[model samples]
Target chain A: MAEAGAPIIEAIGLTKTFKVAQKPPGFAASVRHFFKRTYKEIPAVTDVSFTIRPGEMVGFLGANGAGKTTTLKMLTGLLHPTAGRCVVDGREPFARTRDFLSAITLVMGNKQQLLWDLPARDTLRLNAAIYGISDADYKSRVDELSGMLELTDKLDQPVRKLSLGERMKAELLASLLHGPKVLFLDEPTLGLDVNAQVAVRAFLRRYNERTGATILMTSHYMADITALCSRVLVIHEGKLVHDGELAALLRRFGTRRELRVELSHAVDDAKLRTLGEVLSHEGNVARLAVEPAALVAVVGRALAELPVVDLTVHDPPIEEVVGRVIGKSQRALPNVVGAEQGA
Target chain B: MNAALRKMGGLLSVYYAYMTAYRAELILWALANSLPFILMGAWYQAAAGGAFGFTPVDVTRYFLAVFVIRQLTVVWVIWEFDQDVQRGRLSQYLLQPVDPVWRYLAAHLSERVARLPFSALIIALFFLIFPPARFVPHASDVLLAITFATLAFALRFVMQYTLALFALWTERASSLESLMFILYLVLSGAIAPLEVFPPELRELVMWTPFPYFIWVPARLLIGGADVDLMRATVVCVSWIGSLLVVNRVVWRLGLKRHSSMGA
Candidate 1:
């Protein structure tokens, strides 16, 4: 058993390299390729390492082909790492013991495990059996999780007939039926609408608070990370770039604060630029990128000197901060970046 | 019940539901194995001319038995496993505590259960079309046929699943099954009985696993005097055991190569 406060998930210098077939275009090249195929070794994840203590909800941030999914796959024992090692819940993940598997679950938003033609209840039951949950416990768990997810009435509908959000909720129910202590969620809300995304995010937060389960999740939607995770690990181009508090990440890359101003009358764009860098300007509304140190002064000056109806100062968007981090990492490690992008 | 048994039961019931969801498709899939009837027509005419050892009546009974065996022993694990590997669906099963093989096995079993009623209906229809094709076998022969037919399904499934493991390296592993299927067609007596083959060739083919898949079980149903039941049992068991070992080895190596594509 894993000890309390120990790192339940650990990746030490972990890496994965894929031997991708090189298929050149053109009919002539295709025929030659068919006769004698060649393969090039492309590294997907490079010497990345991180440790998450039990109950930590650490957001995994990355861009497309940035190895977030590959790292999760290796951690879940679905793929063997080409180098280094990973241990989840006190066991080598690649060994895949029943205990190890029972302790962890991986949910990919683009993939599904539910039976498309059958009701979601059937899959929940199957998962219960597979996880060794007794009949009574299974019933109670389903009732509780469904109620929390607001999916109690939808469990009986065929998965193919359900809406995408409902299907995602059902997939979540199936993945969580085992009460796994560790969750690796890759884009849990990839294509969900605002309401669905909020619902999922809220459910995850409540589940985490109640169960104290560790989570390592990746999402293209920045709101998911900002809402659920206080700490994050940022990977760019198959390498770990940042691992610390979410606030620290913002402070590091968020060099400018955003100030939105509503003027009583139209102001000259040049006048707005004198206050701060004018990010955008309309008839009577302007957005400025003010340095964090000068945010209060800029807001006061805008309120006192300009014909301002209202003004608000806010931190830079999490998306911009994260994008800047990725951009910086790409520039810093151009030579070490892997050849292949892993989504 | 224990957790393992409960898991198997759950998987079987769900897959049974899945298979029976489209009732017409089930019947169509069951009827798709009608090649034996087509070959029976050609062989039945030849037998009527006294070209083979058996009379025309014997040819009809043989092909009918072959049809039954085909229904019981048909395995499509290769295609399903290939798709799972290529589409990354296999990762779902791999992440679970149970081995993915058990899931596939349960699906195949459930599909057979869903397909049997339709198969029985088709057999009855065939009997009505040709009354001479029906026969009343001894109870012992009936039981033995069931036993050997089951063994044939097991052997065929394991063989094809072994081939399917190659999907870890190549996306088109079913091509291998297609290539091996030609040998299966010729040697399993789907086209004609082994009695039609030369004695030396028949002797050699008996050592292979293909005959047990169709010929041995079909011949057992007819109580053919040529079948050495003890030898057939030993060979079938031996092949299953050997193939299981090979399956595990290939599966281990395949896992090392698996990239969990399409995720």
Candidate 2:
């Protein structure tokens, strides 16, 4: 049971396994599989547990197929756990009791709850009815969300006619109309442009602050996590790897820093090597990895004696930090950014 | 009671929204559901010169009543259930406060209400064109018809939904649904009267629940009010009640398996 004013979300030893059919590729093999088949039990979520207090904005981070979405589904009562138990507001999620469902909401980026051919407002009205919201509460919440999300102009338009960003804003409004106490947001900003992503992140933060709703969000955009979450839970290969403050994860796994320098005269790779590991050198521009404590001295030496034109020092990009934390090879930095963008 | 009424109202609101969302689709479905009336006209014309237990005029009344009763009692649970499972929309409903089945029922009933205006027009036109002597109303028959029709709808929805659970394991559930429909068409007297079937088949149909889906209710609506019809109404209600319990059990067991397999 949840203590009065305690965490609204709790999980213990949650696990899920899927039995997927395994078939060899080939016409003959396919024919054989029709008669005789093999199956493999793949564990999508291992024994993982976490507690989220009321009004806490927590980011869930993991690589693709790392079980973050699966965990979210379990929390929202979409999928029952294979083993162990979970409770949302002191009720078992899979039971899906009326009171329990009325108190929580799940918003998925790609999936829509809105009626596609109808105006978003229709869906909003439907949700209001489903959640049994009072007319005044519904109107006020819609007004507030409309102003913040800039959805006032688009609410009357059919969802199919709206742009992706517009549709997302409407979706957000529909989910929040019920005024759920807990929110499970799965990649809620997926496929949105940078500006749209920022807008969504800001809206979520404000909504959380204003409503005191506990929010659990999963996103590949480290920027979203960095801006919105004080704490994060990272999972890799269906197992929890790290759970702590976002800054601490950055501090522990974000070891390397990038040093980009522009030289007045093109310097040879050998000279750049003496200062630090030369990450890249082309023409007069070069990038290097410098020790965090020795960054100033290295910059000073390069500027005083070396033919330096410009220099800037910064921590390694978040994509690289996350990739390393997940045990991926760091030899390919550009691919890390690509992977994160794809996610 | 207040809570229940509030929930029902909420569900009706959602149903209205869904219908308004797909007004064009709703129009198309209403047309399709009335196709049986067209078949009735053709069949009635074929038996024009001869009396086959029903005159052409009586055929008109009987088929029109069937049309109205069918419209009221029909459910598309199998299709909706199959689509939800296939498209993964079942998750959204499962997470909601209300049982997914109740939501399905609400949506279905809402569509019925929306189409009532059009269906009432058809009923009115049929009565005006084919005024028959046997169209007299009886209080007992009216009550029995309502009771049987409600049970028939519930039984059919629950049974089909239970069958739809087979999709969790088998990929060919649609084929199974077609087979179920065929059984209903032959034994439930959706295509014709149950008594028209050979004695052996009628006996089999009587022992099964198929007649309760259509034949019993249609018979009651046609003023076949008697103690036997009352007994059949009880049997139909019992079947619906049993199926409801069975559906709950199947859902519990299926959910257990789904959780274990992580679907």
Candidate 3:
């Protein structure tokens, strides 16, 4: 249900560079550089560009320092690009006009906007005031968000006293109180348990469905991508490597399938190896990795040969797929000097 | 303008609630800043009968006023700004519709709002213990002193905040702030009154904004409110204007060059 109307966020040749102090491994070099420093241009996000239509939830996949967060910051107007143009909702983000700021929200997991010593409810009200929300609107929004997130009981306690998961929920409430049209989420579900992750993912999906606000999210967790985002953008070494449907990206890069077999009795390792590369064997269950083409053949024979009670085939995990794709991109790392870096 | 002021009022109240919740910590800080009370006693012993045209009663009034003025004007925003830039906590504010300056300024002002009453209560207890400390000014003088104290607070805050923007370049900006703090202790009438200094040195120190930050307000309240009010207000306003201009320049440059490297 994401927007197909027009692009709300766009970046054209966005670039950012930092002057990194370079020093040799000696006290002499250190002292010399301290006096007359030698520096090099470490490009954080070099000539990157993309466009996000309204109501689209897109995932950004990359390794650490691969310019994922840098690109997000540039898009959010936190950093002025060293060389290019970025406009969000038809206004330059760096200008940070009230209208532009009110239309967008950036949620960074490492930083918080909540009052640490007060209740989350207070912070939410403070945000409402800052965003110029009326009392009726503020109350309705808080009620809706807190009810959806199942955090009604937790809003009254000090933020520091809440668990990690509750605090993240409160963060989501605080960020969404303004009814922003665009959301920039960087690792919003970091350091949470599986159940909490599922809750947050569900809330995000529901929120997107309800509000139709476009969301651009960067996450290391594949579940976050697969569960919430339909489209994905994979960046490696600060260059866009792939951008398409999540399933298609997985198929293009997901080379292996897992074969899970349930045998009547514990099987020997040798027999299991005859079918495919045995990943694990414990009791009557066995998981094996097989080529995509051989997946059916392997599962068919394993059921007939062994005293198999059940068999299932599933796509390879996303971590392995991401690693493989990033590895290939690293090997093909061309002399990408600031110019050929567009999506 | 009305909407912005209303928002600021709401923010200040919210932070006031936060301060109430964290009042225990504020109490500890009140106790921590009581080192000046000891210095007050030292001054009393050194100038037993009279010294430097300051009688025993003058010394008592000066330190009490110093204690209250220091409490009203001191700010830790530099340390906070340094940490925010270094740790990238500033991104949260940058994302919002408001300027981070107003948000932090409200926070700093609200904290003083919460803690000022506690300091006043302590001053009352001091008055009970020390008879010579009872020096109440006229209503107009109190009003003027309040305005001057506010300007003084703004000056010191802007100066520290503007310099703290240096954290965009280095992590040790607070170290520089520590040196400035030492100068305030010596010259701002925190350690000793400007009345006790040599005429030449005192004249020079009084001309700078440091004395205005603490000494003028202190003098207005306790030193018989006898000093030149017009010149002091002019100097405070001029200092505020210069510091605000520097802050705007530094803030722009810092934001341009900031990488927010850590987070």
Off by over 4 Å in 1: A255-319, A327-343, B259-263
lDDT of 3 at A85: 87
In the order shown, the candidates' DockQ scores are: 0.46, 0.39, 0.56
Which pairs of residues collide in model 1?
Answer: A65-A342
Rank the candidate models, highest TM-score first.
1, 3, 2
Model 1's DockQ score: 0.46
Q: Chain A TM-score per model, please list them.
A: 0.83, 0.81, 0.82
Residue A298 CA displacement from its true place in model 1, Å:
12
Q: Pick the candidate with the highest lDDT.
A: 1
Candidate 1's residue-wise lDDT over B203-226, tens digit each?
999999999999998998988767
With a 3 Å backbone cut-off (N, CA, C), the pairs that clash in candidate 3 are A2-A55, A3-A54, A3-A55
Model 2: per-residue lDDT, tens digit, A152-199? 989988889998888898989998887788989998999999888989
Q: Worst ten-residue run, lDDT, model 2 chain A? A: A333-342
Off by over 4 Å in 2: A4-12, A49-53, A84-92, A252-319, A328-343, B38-42, B49-51, B121-144, B225-227
Candidate 3, residues A165-243: lDDT per residue as tens digits? 9999999999999999899999999898879888999999999999998899988778788898988777766677666
lDDT score for residue B229 of model 2: 67
Best by the DockQ measure: 3
